[model samples]
Target: MCGIGGIISFTTDLGERHRTADEFAAALHDRGPESGGRWLGRHALLVFTRLAVIDPVGGGQPMVGRSGAAGGGRPEPAVLAYTGEIFNFTDLRDELTRRGHRFDTASDTEVVLRAYEEWGPACAERLRGMFAFAVWDAAAEQLHLIRDRFGIYPLHYTLTDEGFAFASEPKALFRAGQAQPVVDRDGLRELLGYTPTPGRTVFRDVREVIPGEIVTFGRNGLVRRRYWDLPAREHTDGLSETIATVREIVQDSVRRQVVSDVPLGVMLSGGLDSGIVSALADREVGAAAGGDRLRTFSMEYVYNLANFRSDEMHASPDSPHVATMVEHLGADHSELLVTTDDLMDPAEQLAVVDGMDRPIVGLETHVAFRRLASRMQPTATVALCGDGADELFGGYIWFQDPWYVQAATFPWIGPFHGMEMHSGLVDRQLYQELDVPGYIDQRYQEALAETPLTGEETAEDRRMREITYLNLTRYLRTVLDRRDRMGQAGPLEGRVPFVDHVLVEYVYNVPWAMKNLDGREKGLLRAAMGDLLPDSIVRRGKSPFPTAQDPAYRQSLRSRLQTISEDKSSGVAELLDVKRVEAVLSAPSQGLGAGVNRLSIEAALQLHYWTTECGVEFKL
Candidate 1:
């Protein structure tokens, strides 16, 4: 629930670096409207913009504490600039207090500092939550950058000739002048392809801190090490026991994340994932709040019901199911219905593109996130929802497709993504130069190699491991990054219980057979929460966040694409095949979610504006 940025460089004057840190923090002020601060030293500077989700009146950063070079004994200066919530901070604080650590603030920031003081980098292993933090260990004269196990929080850094700079968003790093936003070949592939390569962003020199990693830098140079990862093991629990354990772990994560100093609610999608979380939250939080009920929210397009139809991707619109859940739970509910006009507003769509810091296409659930966050910010500071569930529980329909499951490349890359659908629109030579398929193959191989493996496993089990790994590492990051941007853009915090590392580790090793016990996608999760939810929700097939289905939206997009094509000065002009574009404009609208031409138009326009806004220069 905050923005963190800093630069650790030996080349710049201390005052100069301090100034840069100020600018870096200023760039992300929207993320932390509550308060902001900066910490400076001879060779290190950390800046923080905080939106208080816990201990609202206290726990400001860059918070400083005392520690030893070896993490014990004589105290010396240790500065911390941290973002994201640590759900286990209360317990850790108690344990640290027992060990004689004194506290002046009732904040998780202090616990994190104390944890590092007591256990050094090993503290990351004992912590459970979403966090991206940078600590200046004055004793060791080294800086440490750490991200959570699932990469729920984003942290990007670029190493420079003098040192390195890190930030909550890549745009902050660009503002700090640590790196420029230039599109290299790989970056182009990443922008055009479904998922970017892990650790690779649209900016050439910029690198995202890989999830579960702790990167440290000192006189010895940079050293990156994994603090956590999926642990492979055999499943031994019976089906009933496994389901029971899943229910327990998931509820624990939800209850733990429900902690907040401000008002909170749930993003009720009406599907099983959000439904399960909202039900548990209502039960637990309702009891704690003296019978007060939980608040829930959902979104829809103005003419969605009229235009929406059952399709391969969406069985039905979310409105009806959402209504069922809201009535069933008897929770306070608000449904925001948006029009195509609201979605196509140039300023708003451009802002979404800039917030993402890449050439992302379409405005499906993403627009809902931003619009809902804006509306909810006044009432709720934290909103919990169901993400990471599908990836973990095999919920995506494509997961059930044997063709995708058996494919040599990542299952979600080609067909599921429509990766090659826009190739014809790209300047043929430029498209050939991007080598999209080659890039996918390489990154897919890299992901496969990184998947944790048990000593021995069945062919099906092994294939499942690869597919799950693809979802966890590649697909999931894209989803998480997008949500974080929009949620924080509203200056609101979004939490996902489904992403808790403990639950993820346990469910990961469960056999695919048990995962689909009812011969349905995400059957295990459905089984676990069945008793708490209505049969309508429990039996409902998986649905993605709703996409605008109105024909007017398609007309608006085509008009914009035509306008962009007419202006040869547009950034995407180099990528377009003029004839192909004409065909796209002339092609019949595919109504709602089914058309490739419609999507291509949307993608082309978004990419053009994103490139222009980010000041990107293509290497090719």
Candidate 2:
């Protein structure tokens, strides 16, 4: 919903960087173009750019407030700059007010600031929402960075020679001009290896604030304390009770999230995840607002339907199902049809990397949608989707496949190993030094250890839980990041009720048997919302976001790669074997395979563009 960045230290350069923080905040214009501001402290500086989704008139950034418990002589330690939506701000506000807290504005930002003053870092435990915020504690001379339990919001920070710098997006840190977008050997490995090593990022010095953590940077150095984590416990609820609880929590999350001062809508797909969100949103919005039609949007490739074939990931084109739901719900729907040229556009592809500030493993669709959303629904600021449902409810094909689930390492890597060569063309010694295999295994073990697999457990249950945790922490992290970058680039705020901490925690503890009941992926969810949606939608199988299947798209990529290959002084040429690159390009591609060749070409092209355009330096 907003962008927040700041620098803290005894660095004298604050004079220039404070003003540069303006550009740092300005770089996120797509994320929040409505308004912006900067606040400078003797030893700290903060910046905020806002979308103004709530109490637009009253809420603005780099806000300063006194702690509720501060004594008359004590210094007011807390100054807050935040980005996110606190769905339960109203409830928290009332409780704080009852306890003698006064408010000057009718906005959630004030409620959060007051809550922090009243509770300190402990405030995160009492709040329920997706948020990333910074609180400068002047009394302690400490800077605090906090992220949501599941990390739905993005926060990255790192210590510098002068002090610490933090930002909602990595590019903001770059714009601040303290840290370079230079990834070293290890950063390169994580970038290409397809592993989500918590805290590690593509930039050598910049790191993500791990989910559920409140990290404090001060004179004593950095300390991290986790505020919440998934608790493993025995399932006591019967099938009926579990389903009822799922329905209740999920409905409530959607109910709270749909509240917005700006235009709000749902990102609809034929899949069960988005369908259920659409259905619940429709009912909730209708009942609350005199039966207005729900607004929904879906994207499709220009000739995808004509070229579509049944694959492991998709059973049918989304057109028919989308149509069925549009008519069934009587919703206001818009379909954006994009050509292969649109998907392959170098500028659009470049925007994807620019938006992410890394060579991320996401589809080109994310980039296209960032532009499409603005054109289709310029007024729509908030949109909800079912992002984490697959990881939570076992909707992916591998979740149901015995062979894939039983593998030792992360389930996705083996099948997609070839794609892991994001920097395959890099000098061989550099690639060898990356130790992609070793890095992936190390990260996998770290994640597995954090998963509390207590009590007696069957091999099946334990393995499934590990797999689920991997998807939740790693796969889902990438998914959420991609969604944020894309949606924010559209200047639209994307929310996911399926990622509600309570819902994720509850469904996580449920036995796999219930989640995949009757041998179907997401079976419990289907049964819970069966009567609410048409059988056609509830029965629709999982389909990954659609991609352009046209050969022309592949040709466009191939041609560009060929052109770059011939350039003797190409920035990417030193790392690549031109003959080998030419061979791969000449090899057959149906333009539809989701395998090594497709991904390698995509990654290589992306890396080239990013390195050349962004002028990324390899400090290796």
Candidate 3:
């Protein structure tokens, strides 16, 4: 795991290139703190920061490879600046060696470079891990950027007058002057609306390299080809057979991901998705002779344990379940209890906004993850997370609720909820111009049109398939991005085993009936791994990540929103509706958490800070 940035410009001066490269490296310093280097070509410059996970002594970048003299007219050279892990690099290296390729270092970086040489662009099909990489082929005078099948890792790039610049995060591009901190009307729609367009970012010109995609750029302009996508296939396996297949795929993914040189741990949320991962990891570690006990980490709000209340979103606090699992596995566990003050800290909130490079909702959760990553960094470099399972296996409550399921728009942003939370504080005229509702419906239809189907399913099955596709493609990307930014901010790599393409493809084809076997969310997963976990965990209802229920947290948001409303020169003041802001401030404390008012206040404050601190220019 590392941070990578590069520029492919034929017109920029050498001095300017050096300055940009330096800024890129500095911006990404936290992502790779161990070492850093730069590779300069006549028309390309690559900068890499190293985390040294696979082979501490030998693994480094940007790695360069040259073709053999035999059958090679003027030995071609290719340079690679890569991030994320290739869990199957050992197998690829063996195959490449059999094909007469030699290696100088025991690193996945070398295997990736050789794979590019041996298979060219087709090599992306063979890789089975989370990654985003850039390859500069001097011979072709082209740059190739590739992201993993599920986009567990992030890569952003922007087109420039001379050429283009790419990086693991958008701040690196902005710092290097490759892109500006600007948001247009459409970008605001994307932000204020809960729906996420696949390749679009909050920043104007910066865009993501969509998952399972390879983008190539050169003097002939740019070309994009999708190397993989969720396949539409008929389900032939019976219920029992499907369960076994899911177990096998998930276990193999966990086993492959646990092979890390640096210390590793699991993020145990005490929910079924994370519990299954922890159990499998424990079994894998115990199977190894003389292996130490597996390490697990979890977090909760400081006052949540005593004052927690049941709601539709959170069924129960995670502490008791976490204890049950830790005892069942006899694991070495660590838990952090975060205070309301910690969640409300101005400096901490600013750090998260800066780290994310956008005004993000759920400030508390992001802050909690950042704190958890910092706690784990001293002992582990890699942490397994259960992010994609909910999206893949239908674990969210909205998935099972009839109203949400039958809604015309994206289920998460059904007519009654979610969308209003983001737009409640914005100016009425501006909100009308943004037209978040229209944008949501438009994007929703676009996503539904892209939903793959076999055409032989019942009406219910077809609708379920569309819902699953929306969750995986749109909702899950936001979850994955949050994990990437927070974990990488701690310089920790968070791996999602459930997101393995083989597993996603297989389960995506499973009929909704089989997925909801017992009329429960994630019933398929529970059936597959239930025996491995305590019964309580297997039976626990679906609960989203815990949040602070303390009224003081809401009180803090009200105070901040009040201050912003009073200050006419505030960066986000013009964007907000003063009447709406005053309504929130003057509302009774007891009425704060009712509906989505609390969420709206949080969003407004985050936007204010992001605009002020990042110098974001609004083009509305």
Candidate 4:
């Protein structure tokens, strides 16, 4: 909802800390354009740019409150800075008010400050929305930072001698100089591993607060604690109950997220996730005054011939699936199409690299959305995304492995060994020096080992926890980061209804048999929406976010790779085997082994870009 940044120097004065906080806030100015404020206290100072979501008249942040134990009034107040929307504030506010909590504003930010005042750290459990917040407890001289249970919002922090500095984005923290500019090589390896975990950012020193986790930095030193976890449970609800509950939760989630001062829209892929979100937005906005009918956008390509050149051409047939629901919703719709040339812009690629703070996969569409969002920014400040459905519903192709999908393990947390050929593209010694393979293997093992697998259960059951965990901890976070960076970069707010912590918990606890009853993934969600969406739209199979198929995009990548190889001054030149790289891209991609071309070339290209642009030094 807004951008928050601050610095806490254990041994510094107000003047120095205020200066640093200003820079941090300035770095995030685009995230919150309505208003900006700074709160200077005894030990720490906070600054926030306000988007004016809840209380346009009074809801400016860096909200301060006196700390108290439960109902008792305190001598001093805690200074709080937050960046997110708390959807359940009306309910929380009423309850707190009954409990004798008074408020000065009709804003969720104030409600959150009061909630923390009334319940201490336990306040997070009572919250039900997407948020990442930092509370500077001046009395306790501790900085308490918390991220939502699903990590739908971001909070990156770095520990410094001055104290702990945190912000809504990595760029802000980078500006604060609390963290080094060096890219996190290990994280790059993990991304190459195809699992960019949410908790780790590209900067080694800048770490994101993991979902459901809290960190308190005080004189006792920094302590990280888990405030929540999705406990595995057996689903006892009837089929109908499970279906109805999912529908209700999703509907409620979408309705709550639509509450922004500015107009909002939906990203409709005509897929079930976006379909459901669009339907909910369509219904909600109608009942609310001064709101616009939901605007939806889907990407397409000229001629449909763009497929042959798609940088990530999948032999398994797929297409942009959007028309069904867009027509049904009867909402304002725009299908933005681009040529291979549109996506091949080196400048756009560089912008994406800079936007994400690292070279990334799926940049083509992310960049596309950035452009699309820019066009929509004149009409809307926020857009709802259907990002978490696939991970939560066991919708990946690999999940088709009955054992893997159901085996009480994480479904999307696997070693996509397709990067081996790309590893060959690099000098064997330099590749080993990067220790890319070992680094990637470590992340996967850590992910799998974190899940408790019982041999007795079906593969779906065993992998349930792991898959859901990966969705929440890794994939979902990446999507959130992408949506947040892209949307905010265009000065638009991005909301993910599927990442609702309450719904995530509910889905994770649903019995595997119920989740994919009769061998259909996401069967529960489909049944839940029974009549809300047209049967055709609800029944459509899952398709990942749309990507370009333009042959020029592939050619562009090839050209970029060639340029990287020929540019002897490029840092990546030392690590790459020019001959092997040429052979891979020059040949037909069909003969590449399972998961080979997509994974390897992507990694090789990402690595080359990182070394040349991201300033990532290849150790080897």
Best by TM-score: 3
- C-alpha RMSD by candidate, in order: 2.3, 2.3, 1.8, 3.6
lDDT of 4 by residue, 351-463 (tens): 67666766566667777877777776667777887888877876665555654554332344333323363454656565566687577666767877665343455754766
Please give, for residues 433-550, the per-residue lDDT of candidate 1 as tens digits. 7787787788888888989889587888788878888899888887887778888657888899999889989999999899988789999998898898999999999998888888
Choose 1 or 3, whichever is better by lDDT: 3
Minimal lDDT window, size 10, model 3: 67-76
Clashes of 3: 0
Best-to-worst TM-score order? 3, 1, 2, 4
Tens-place lDDT per residue, model 3, 1-620, is: 68999989767644346787899999998789899888987789899998888988888889888855421222668889998899999999999888888888998888998899888878999999999999998888899999998788889999987789999999999898888989999899999877668888988999999999999989888899999989999999999999999999999999998888889899999989999988888877742324798899999997899999998788899999999989988888999889999998898888888888886768899999989998997778889988899999999877899988998988876634653776778888998887888998899999999999999999999999999999999989879878888886567889999998899999999999999989999999999989998999999998988888998998898888888877777789888876677677775642344344666777888888888887888988
How displaced is residue 571 in candidate 3, in Å? 1.0
TM-score of each: 0.96, 0.95, 0.97, 0.89
lDDT of each: 0.83, 0.80, 0.86, 0.71
lDDT tens digits by residue: candidate 2, 401-485: 8777876788876555345446544555666766777887888888888886766668778888888899998889888888888
* Candidate 4 lDDT trough over 10 residues, lowest sum: 310-319
Clashing pairs in 3: none
Total clashing pairs for each candidate:
0, 0, 0, 22
Candidate 1 colliding pairs: none
